[model samples]
Target: MRFFGIFCIVAILCCDLAAAESPLVVIVHRSRHSPISVEEVARIFLKKQRYWKDGAPVVPINREARSASRRVFEQYFLVRVRSDLVAYWNEQYFHGVFPPATLESDEAVKRYVGADSNAIGYIAADLVDDSVRVVHRLD
Candidate 1:
């Protein structure tokens, strides 16, 4: 019984560490197969590029402001500090452009992106499935 208990604890800790280290993936609906670069993704998230090649409005979904995934996404993709990003959004608000809509969890982001052809969002790589196609990965 003692050996079993210790084994379980070690297994749980290993799982947690693996989950924490999972890469982040940017996803679109499964139907979207076009290649997108990091710069273009940044532009879309910033609301600078508002439409897809087919004239459909590009919808960028962000994880909530307080999420760790959001921090990573902004760091790797936006490449702007929080204060600078805030200032940029402030300027954009004046021009009628706004930051992307935010969802609270990876599951929600996946569902939204899966349902909308023009929508794009990011989630932990481990959560990815058939509902969405990964367009980028931040390793």
Candidate 2:
């Protein structure tokens, strides 16, 4: 029983450490732009600012609320608690400005952004590749 308890604790700690170390990166279609500022990225994700400078409608994609990347994006960029975001979105819905569409996994987000010229999304930095260009990285 003692060995089992110690093993469980170690396993939990390792998982937590891995999650903390995984960097989050904001990605957009490779053809769009590179190294966009964090503030602009935040505005895009928040739906406060729409349309890329070239007159293309910005399509922001989000990971599921409970995903690790989503948590980091909400806490760091959005700067609001989940409940407050819920309320904000509710208000936005009334105004016909819905929140960004959510995908189940980072792979899906990458694929979506890669396929759409105006789409942007966030994912683990390690998952980034030539398919998408990273605009911002959050450690």
Task: Give the number of the best model, judged by TM-score.
Answer: 1
Cα lDDT of model 2 by residue, 41-90, tens digit: 77888898898888889999998776667888889888889898999889
Global Cα RMSD, each model: 5.9, 4.7
lDDT of 1 by residue, 25-136 (tens): 9999999888999999999999989999889999999987876788888999999999999999999999888789998678889999999999999998999999999999
- Return the lDDT, model 1, position 76: 92
Candidate 2 vs. true structure, TM-score: 0.82
On lDDT, the leading prediction is 1
**Candidate 1: residue 113 lDDT (0-100):** 95
Candidate 2 yields a Cα-based lDDT of: 0.84
TM-score of each: 0.85, 0.82
Model 1 / residue 106 / CA error / Å: 0.4
CA displacement after TM-score superposition, residue 94 of candidate 2 (Å): 1.3
